[model samples]
Target: MNAIQFGEPVSGKTVSARVSPAGGLDILSRNEVARLRDASGSGLHQLLRRCALAVLTSGNLSDEPGTIFEQYPDFDIQVLQEDRGIKIELKNAPEQAFVDGRIIRGINELLVAVVRDIVYISTQLESGGFDLDETVGITHAVFEILRNSRILRPQVDPNLVVCWGGHSISRDEYEYTKRVGYQLGLRGMDICTGCGPGAMKGPMKGATIAHAKQRRKGNRYIGITEPGIIAAESPNPIVNNLVIMPDIEKRLEAFVRLGHGIIVFPGGVGTAEEILYMLGLLLLPQNQEIPFPLIFTGPQQSAAYFEQIDRFLRLCLGDEVSRHYRIIIDDPAAVAHAMVSGIDKVRNHRLDNKDAFFFNWALDIPLPFQQPFRPTHEAMASLALHRDRPRHELAADLRRAFSGIVAGNVKEDGVRAIAEHGPFVIDGEADVMRALDDLLKAFVAQHRMKLPGGTAYEPCYVVRT
Candidate 1:
């Protein structure tokens, strides 16, 4: 690969080069190549370009997608099909993605993942390869996407732990997440997350040291993201294995299906959305028997955060929702121990049910949780957030409410929608709306809604009784 310096006066230094696929997407059909190269109103090139930029800009802190695009407006990528293999051409790309005119190896692999998933989803999944209407079909599609990424192992025991939390968090909370990760890593556990900074990076960072001390080989630090959220939360530098699902619902599904346990830290609406999604599934009658481990933890200072979450869950879904998870405060060792013990139970449960260790096929996720939610103003306004619905149903709608808030806060389309329209109007039962308003007020006051030190946050949604 050679860097071709261009004469473009830009804010940051840009590089142009052609790099071959490191270990993915080595071969593609003529049609596939054409689809990737097609730069029209109806093609995959724009999507490919956006995702590729996100991979190249790994470790970026900005949650706004437009900022990155505006910074590198001249940046472009082209997929060149050749008999030997495929070559990706970068133009005016982020200079940080390269060193001394050579692309970073990890970044290169992740870039290839961008190309692979974008092409595969555009050609295969969206083209009748999977029946997305059925719940089983959706689960199968998630499994296939993960399987294609080659992260799933057939002979491994249950050790993967998924960590969820806000990208914006306190230094103390971040350190606590790392400590918990250190303990988990010393016990030979792998880590998976949304693949951004803050809590997501902390566990992987701490685990690296522990993994080295224990001489653990082939350790996986996986990051799963969707197109809508990837630009806002680029895969952190520690993410060795990154998979881009088609959307948020599938992304969340992949997390639960692939992970043996989960640890949730203090976070904002996005984190709450993840918690509710998991709880919604667990509340289902069929999932009651499954041995899945869920834990909510943080530093002592953040105890009230989890308490508020607990209260909101109870208020929205009833007291029974508390049975599905345990809260541990300021005890990383205990958190790791609980996860280790819980994973053992998960292993036995899978074996008893004749399920695969790499993927939890026996977990019953209802269609509501599997379906992708498009959070338009009308859709957000019409959510069935009343307590009269079933607990699972209410949890699903509540999850959607938070999901829409996340979109408005970060995702490109949602931000644009909020700009064109006003804040999303969320109406529910009087008590539920009051509880939600209180919880959201706490999040805003704690600076959980956006990266700390940014300008004061404006509400993205109005909760109405």
Candidate 2:
């Protein structure tokens, strides 16, 4: 948290800043540095700019990705190869990220992480450093990205918990997440999430207080995100460590590989996508024996929400799939106790199998799930959502269906695609389609599709029954 030396503040909503590396990475090659500032269409500049802008304007409530960029149209960022090391050059950046003419330390650290990850993935992966075609290659790439970001630590037990839910949720559900997080923190567990507001922010918020009370050190509030969704759900400042994966698939893989257990709160399509992804992984015959704790919990008011989710899951994946997760309502202490208990089993399993404490190397992530899914109109229509296929395969398709809705709703490309092509048409089994339609309707009725203050949401997709 040293005093920052940034350019003179401008009079408007933007300011000029130069951020030195606070953590993760400090040095970079000249070519890599150049690409970071390249303004060409294929260069990393635009990707860097949009993602960096999202981080600068942390705590934004808009689910629309383009809104923030429109506000700071002239905002830009660059990386400089300095004699000492690397320095980030910011022009017309959000002034809110600064405090008394200096960039906030936590934000600066996260900014460095964003820059570090972007540069690493762009330079190394693009140069064929990691083969991403196969499942093993993809898993290795995720591991390397995490290791490079310094997110993986040795000699640590299985205590990191991943919490997933909508960026926009009701106040009661959000409070419930915090209560669960406080109890988890008191038991010395770390927190990971998508790094946005609502459910994502709540757990970290609660954990901080609990960590302080317990005099915890090196408390990890990790936020894993991607470029496409950064604007829609900006990283909250409470996130001490942030890793921007190459894509949503990689981001989701990072969650399962890094977290010892998972707790899901009520959310819209994005949350449903996560639940499906987890179940799909566990349902695999190879992964059936893996002890991955999954729990869905919320306030009492959201009981029907989980019930609907449970029903949809059963209709799609069959009753046996219920073994993969537990649905707990209105009991924060009980949820925490369950997570701790599950993680204990995880610790034992990892020990008996000789797996690393930081990474779940034994868990199997299939090629279908590892590959990035482009939620195009055609892709949406081509999904195999019928029950004739294997349960895991069907789960994967359902996950993709929700993923498309998420993209169309928030991600810049998905939003633009929907605008140009109209709502995506999801063709699937009649029963499954009925279940999905009903569940999505519940999300909309509960105002979970978008932030409460925004305009009423028009669904970006239509399921063909």
Candidate 3:
């Protein structure tokens, strides 16, 4: 219930100094620095500091953001304005972020992304420049965020595979993901992920070797994350391109838009939320014809986990829901082969439909799935999880339910809220609740709820069956 503890030992640590931006973020307006320095009640300074710390502490194996802050309570980052550009000053950052007193190149790039996203969001809100109330407006905001991050490639083919799974996966599952990544990479496909550890890192790590073997040049290992979950799931070191969306909604949207095919590794509620979100979108009549290749895969040991997920999906969304994705068990080569083939179909479909290869413009995402779902006590209780509504609509609510659990499990604010206000009461149809409870119980029982070496797992949500 208290602030979740985090970070490794800091004993025998000393201060370090870093120079100009590593990923080409060398300029920021005076206004941006002012906002970043404003640690007051309504300021962005605190958020900036927390996110910056997460980047500097990249490759952290911890899932508790509170622990990171607790370990470095005195850690402070300052945005210094210079005539030519901006310079970030760290008061007590992690020594691991630096080598020979110089900030690591990748970490510096991630740090700039934090500053870039924070400033951009602050500017949008202050100027009333972004219309986030409507579905289209929200999508536009997501697009602009991606564009500003320079992640939208203009001419690249649709080869980016978004690998979604838990950060606390078992070693076998993690190794399996790398093999799949290696296969995908050898065939010239790129990797995109939530940008954390476990499954997220495995694929990127594997691809590096495969790319080297193939003599592939200019490979992109993109890591997309959001502020709320960034600290808990720090960016892994393998991510060459990192972009931080403002929230989970935008992060999910970025994945669905940027990825040609999706490969789901064994995961917990967070992964379920992602699967539900994508399925909910595909279930819509408008998106039924879209050629989006989605596969649920893992090593032989993880077959049961995906089987449980498949059964849960069938029960909640009906047998027809299985049509949206394929399940590949234990075969890394086959999973990669399927993904490569699926991406080819996606390419042809996009070309025929005149959709952008960089972003899937043909796939239509409805308002419910695009808008941010705030996981407050009231909001969580008010979710329409019953089966009376359209199947896609029900899936949206189900996604929200899982999203709330993910927040409570890791997000700092969500964790604090659950601590103060008991567990979140997720009410729904009796049958649906039974299936939901069963799936979540499996997650807890299998030690998938948190990192393996951390504290014992506890349910943050309560299913009112």
Candidate 4:
């Protein structure tokens, strides 16, 4: 397939000239620009460079963060201050982000987002204005970060649907995701995803076509991701708005807070982690009365896959786990209809409770779930994945275990930890460990753990009973 390149008019040759900020990012203080240019050990320039590289290399599908650094070892981006605004000078930038020496408009927008988010977070940290302690403080930080990104739009009804799935999936499954996305779009619902390929990109692609047919204006294709996973799963070109949260925990929080409903596709450990997170949240007694739409769907060929997921949920979280999500197979129209009808209930619930339509402020998220879990060897081993605890607590720990596995598979830090040490050792109750082992073995057998036709996936986890 030919590359989809868009240009904003320039000379015959690709431009190698420096450019200034277009709209939102202009007129930074001299101190801020200096900090951005600093590459020394104490500077924030390294973070800026990494994020900018990820945005410039947008269409590259490999999920490896280190590869970008290796390929462009000397790549450096500096912020330049001028009389009118700020200019970004790229050193060893990717050629693909430019056409006739001009950066593509959408990529430029994303690049601006990269700068905006990194700078905003850095300033917040430097100022010591962000509270990292206490549940309310952490949630406030999340809200601030999102609000700074301009993602929180008030007065809009709940219509954002978050799609969670693996970057690695079968072609048939990917196409099925597009079908579901098309149906959802026809109903005027927008999409948000992890912004990778496979199922992540499929829905956005489908929604664009549907939106075009319906003559919809200002349709949103939002992509929420973190730095660790962005390199491997580069933002697909279809994502018009992109926001990089600080970590995976914040990223997940952004999803639940911003989206009105969720549609999960066929995925591996990452998808499982997402499911467990939502279940853990909804199972809390406070959130029991709240209405949230969740559906597990795929083509008919994926029936057995859903069955395995359903069985695992029943075995681990109990029979009542089935009440939170519905399984719809081989019917995109039915899936969309379910979401439309279900999201209506969600709207009614929010109105009845007088909750904000833009964000789910009432959901109770424990501090453990809100805190970022660094998947170190010791940390992974220390997870309390037993059944003696309350069902919700157990579910949270189970989610953490799977989250570590996902990190081992894709995230750069997690991959390095697995490489340095051995597989993460998970010891839990006998039944829980056995169930975990069975589920992981199935994922490996079905090749859901790795990118299609790429390297074979070896388990990075050792389940002990």
Candidate 5:
């Protein structure tokens, strides 16, 4: 299998390769292969190409998808169906993904994951394989996607902790996340994250050393991402298992369904979006009794950040919402201890409810939470952020508001929309809008919206309080 072949350099370096699958996607039907090869107006090839390029150029710093696309404009990929099995063909690929001539083993595996997920989702999920209309059906679809990716382990206990935070964070905050991850690792807890740099990469980096110290074998450092955001935030090297959900909502659901607990580090609107999503679910009557541990922690410098977050939550969701999460400031060891204790409670709760250890099947995720929220200008403007609605409903809308800001800040389509539409307009009840405005102002002042070294961030939305 001499797959490596030198090709004309697109920018200093380019390589063409016909690589065999690592394990999961070794076989494909003729129709599937055809769909992957079709680069027409109606085919999976463009999506596959974008996702494949993202994986091939993993670890690149810039999150601007346009930057990546412009740099590798001629880069292309194809899924070849040979007599024996399947192989991927790359044209003008990133040189960093290769050593000497062969593709890096881990990159190849992740590339395979990109292919496997894209193909499965395009072919199966869009068809009748999984229902997308109802809440339970959508969740079942999420479970099936994870199962097909070979990530869910039936025998493993609830130990995977989903860490959510901004890819762009301060040096002190990044280090703090690592210390927390090290503590979690020492207690044999695995790490799952968004799989980019900064806070996403820090915990996994810390866990590696602790896992080595404890001789923890088969430690899962999983990274769950989506196609829209994958290019901006490439998969970090520490991510051993990568699964790309179809959208942000699904990606968020996958985190809640697959993990035992969640730990949120200091972040901007994206992290706030995640916090709201989880809290909104927990605020529901059906999910009130479910033992899901959520902690918001960072270094002492980040205490004010969490304070703003806390204040915003109380102002919007009321004082009762504060009970959903514990704010632990500057204490990594205490955070881990609390998580360990909390996870034990999670395990017991699951056992009492007769739920699967690998997936949180018993939790009732409402339909609004399950369905995808497209952050178009109209959609963003139409959000009901007033206090007249039910608390949970209002929380869901708040979650959507932040989610739209997240899109405007990072996602390619969102960036383009802002460029064309001149910022999304967000209007709501005066008090909620004021609190939201204050929180967003803090995020921008702290440089939480863009990566640390990137260009200055312009406001992507206007707040009408």
Candidate 6:
């Protein structure tokens, strides 16, 4: 691994280097090599470039995917296979990803992960290895992705807690997430998050300290992400296991399947989408007996945030939906204790059912929830957000509405669609629409939905009542 001292004219902080992958993959077939090197419209080079750049500039808070590419227009990476292994060649890469003259090991592993996942998914799709047309096929695809990443631990118990929340959460909320994480870690639970900043990062950060104090070894801090959202929310430094799913739906499914329990911190539409997705599944009659522990928590200052979420959830799904989760504000220890107890139940249930400790095979995720939701204007307007339908179905559409707004707010395609087509119009029942509007407005008011830099938060969709 060698580095050139001179920086590109476009950026002074950038450098060119040849570095070997720390982990993930060592070699690729002749066909895979061509697919990666091909920069044409049909190739994977552009996607590789995007994800690799995000890895090179890890921990950047900005969610603007366009701005990053614009900032480093000359940056490029190539996968070169040698007789022994492969070497990653970089041009105009972010220097922060390097230490002195060498690429950071973690960043290198993440870059390898980018190459590995992109190649795996693309290869599977082309070879018809994934059957996305049906429900079981989708779940199988998710399992295969995780298995290839090698993050699953069959020998381990049910102790991974999936944490969800807004990446741009407030300082108080961020600290609260850490507190919750610390308590969970002290009790021997590992963490998995979206692998970005804010709430996604806090739990992992807190757990590191607790794990050290407990002298725990082989602790897993896994970060699950999708390509579209990767630039907006780069994998945080704490993530030792990074797995990139093909899309958001697969990523969400990965979370539910991999973790025994989940804790939701205060967040924006993205968090809401996660909540709705989980509730929609739990509300299913088939999932009624499943004992997945879900807790919503924040500091005292953020109690109102949960309250608003609770209100909106009840109005949208029904009061009975509350049975699946519990809210514990200003109590990190209590939240952690609850999660521990809940996971014990999960362990016993899994043991009785002869299920795998690493994956939840019993969770019945329908095809609708597993399918990729393109937040196009027409798609957004087509979502049925009213409560006249079944609660799970409504939850699914409501999740889509929030997901579209999320896409518009962060994902490159969603952002471009919004810019070209204007904000999406979300027409639903009067009361439900009003409730959603109020909840979103509150999020904006509380600064949960922070925009790039100082740009004020703007609505990406109009909730028509």
Computed on alpha carbons, the lDDT of every model, listed in order, comes to 0.90, 0.88, 0.86, 0.84, 0.88, 0.88
Q: lDDT per residue, candidate 1, 264-336, as tens digits?
A: 9988999999999999999999889999999999999999999999999998899989999999999999999
Give stretches of model 4 more than 4 Å off: 1-17
Worst 10 residues of 3 by lDDT: 1-10
Per residue, candidate 4 scores C-alpha lDDT tens digits across 345-384 of 9899989989998888988888989999988889989988
Model 2 gets an lDDT of 0.88
Looking at model 4, report the run of 10 residues with the lowest lDDT sum.
1-10
Comparing candidate 3 with candidate 4, which one achieves the higher lDDT?
3
By the TM-score metric, which is better: model 4 or model 6?
6
Candidate 5 regions with alpha-carbon error over 4 angstroms = 1-12
Residue 368 error, candidate 4, Å: 1.0
Runs in model 6 with CA error above 4 Å?
Answer: 1-12
Model 6, range 1-465, lDDT digits (tens) per residue?
011111122233788999988977968998998899999999999999999998877866467766678778899999997888888899999878887989988888889899999998999999999999999999999999999999988888899999999887767787888988999999999999999888888999899999999999999999999988898888888899999998889999999999999999988889999999999999999999999999999988888888889999898888998989999999999999999999999999999999999999999999999989888888989888778899999999999998988888888888888888899999989999999889988877776665435577778889886
Cα deviation at 29, candidate 1, in Å, is: 1.3
lDDT of 5 by residue, 1-465 (tens): 011111122242688888887878878888888888888987889889888888887767676667778888889998888888888889989888888889999899999999899889888855788889998889988999999999999977889999999887877888898999999999999999998877888899899999999998999999999988888888888888999999999999999999999999988888999999999999999988899999999999889999999999999999999999999999999999999999999999888878899999988898999889999999999999988899999999999999999888878889989999899999999999999999898888888887655567789999997
Q: Which stretches of candidate 1 lie over 4 Å from their true place?
A: 1-11
Candidate 1, TM-score vs. the true structure?
0.96
- The sequence of per-residue lDDT tens digits that candidate 2 reaches over residues 224-300 is 99998887888888999899999999999999999999999988889999999999999999998889999999989
- Cα RMSD of all models vs. native, in order, equals 4.7, 4.5, 2.8, 3.6, 4.8, 4.5
Which residue pairs collide in model 1, if any? none
CA displacement after TM-score superposition, residue 302 of candidate 6 (Å): 0.6
TM-score of every candidate relative to the true structure:
0.96, 0.96, 0.96, 0.94, 0.96, 0.97
- Residue 57 lDDT in model 5? 79
